[model samples]
Target: MKTMPVLNTIKKRLSAFALGVVDLVVRFKRTTEKMFLPWDKWVKPEGSIAREKLFSRFPRYLKEPAGSVRCGEGWYPLVWDLCTAIEAMEHLGMPRIGHFKAEERLGGLFVRVESGSFIVKELARDAEHRAAAICEECGEPGSLQLGHGFAKTLCQLHAAQRKPHKVKTVPIPENLATQRPKLLFLDTEFTDFDYPQLISIALVAESGESYYAELENGWSREGCSAFVVEKVLPQLTGGEFFQESGYAARRLREWLAGFGVPIRVVTDAPGYDWVLMLDLLHHELPPNLYPTPLNFYSESLPELRPLLKQAHDDACRDLSPHHALQDAEALREAWEVMKEHLHPAILRQYLKL
Candidate 1:
């Protein structure tokens, strides 16, 4: 007893319609719930600050019908991080904060939690250190700004009245008046698992000049991690600029010569990138070019880690990460933050700028 073909099709369409109606109802309910929540806007985007000032009165943690928590005393940028930490504490178990204040002298955020778990206490301490690195005003990347012989974490813009900030000035070297040690940050996406067969390459200079090209027959590696699939794949949409490996190699060599002398290349993954680049370039890099990792100068510069982290935090990223140029720009940004601390002559010599 087979049903008519038209009757079966009608039944399938009805089922689809029923499911669509149910889905709409579910979505509408969720949208209504979010609309009523007072603090929904804060955490949606990571860096955007939620609140500027804390409530002066009681019920800091608003109850049902208007669920929200207030920070005791943190301003822009750092306030975002502070609220994030408090939200984490709420999930771990709401540890009621009895007193909260900014400790400028200590470079910390002090939150006295009266109840709940020990993790709240730890988070309180964590927030304090983070606050020290972030400016309480603008969210821009800044260090602990000190003025009038007093220390406060703030960006240069907000801390305008602070004690004279030192900036190292270096003159162009006499012998190589026109040439500077331009940073060429190189990063690659490759084909091989154990041995890197080159797939794509990006070279970013300090001036924001970038040369990016992918091999026409670049072998697409299988079994890549989820990160590569989700993040890297979408960005690598092919372009007409992409060329055969051999032609691209010679063009790259000619471009290198255009810079005149001494190209300092930085690679985070030194071993893999060096091997892949050498293979792509046919033999080895030119005599004037030297590639080293961020760790190369780490021993002499013990302060680089914190400086780098702070620089990274403060930067408003202009380019997408994983692409070679953006990663290089990041490295340059970190070094720029630390330049004033370096002797002017040494800085010029080191960066060739």
Candidate 2:
């Protein structure tokens, strides 16, 4: 009966050795580590394995491959020195038994003898494909779509789309030309009066013989009818003296770009209106605008009278402050009130008129 225990022990030892061989073969065959895995996954590093023991010590191999030590799909074979074989076994859970290099098993995983050569090639190919798909504009993944309209692997949102150009027209009054540069009148309407939140800008500028303008985005309910009536009409008619809004600032910055000269953006108070212009030019305008500081301050216009009285009364009674468009109109009215009283040369020094 005692002999039966010894005989059973010998049988168990032989079974363990056989099972280890199976672990080695299955892991070695599926070795694609030389090729790139998907971006979402990572591989265990090589060189983490200790020296291999004789087949007897690993008794669990007799039963089955350990469910706890299951191999990941991405693991590949690497062989040369025992150290690499040991690394594959311990770190990557790969086969380390037998002379795989001599048997040509290693060649199945890698073209060369280098340990990580397979992974290197696969990763390189994936990187090149990713780089080719990136958009030059806006710098977001798949934002730009170019070339073919069909036969694609990635989603449309990840692709870039081309945008068209649009341009609009606005008039510049002849009277204000003498006090400021050949100016561009810009304006914007917002859905709300919230700071740093702009919905759209309406710009008007003179290009050589004709005037050009455009709106950045179409006006919304929060920005349109009331804004045009309360804001736009006042500036055009010279009923108010200040209309400091996002639309005005955008146009001012755009104008400053083409002309190398600094522009004096006239407002009712140079201090108040100019401050708004500086903020728009420095912080809000696009990179193409290339804005620098320019002179801004309220230069009292020639026409000062019943208009000022009305403006002051409105300011006191309305509670809500009138902005840039109103100021544009007020400036026009003020000039009409005093244009004949001012020196012609001084007017010529500041304005194109």
Best by lDDT: 1
The global Cα lDDT (0 to 1) of model 1 is 0.53
Q: On residues 1-353, what C-alpha lDDT tens digit does candidate 2 reach at each position?
A: 79999998986675555445544743463265435654222232343322122112222321133201111111111211222333444455543332212111111111222234333233323333442333222223332222222211123432211111111112343432333454433333332322212332322333321112222322223223454456543433222312344455555555555565333333333332333344344445433331322222223333434444455454434332343333343433444434455577755643534
lDDT of each: 0.53, 0.33
**Highest TM-score scorer:** 1
Model 1 residue 217 lDDT? 52
lDDT of 1 by residue, 84-129 (tens): 4454445445655544443334333454444454444454455566
- Model 2, position 141, has a per-residue lDDT of 39
| TM-scores, all models, native as reference | 0.43, 0.27
True-structure lDDT of candidate 2: 0.33
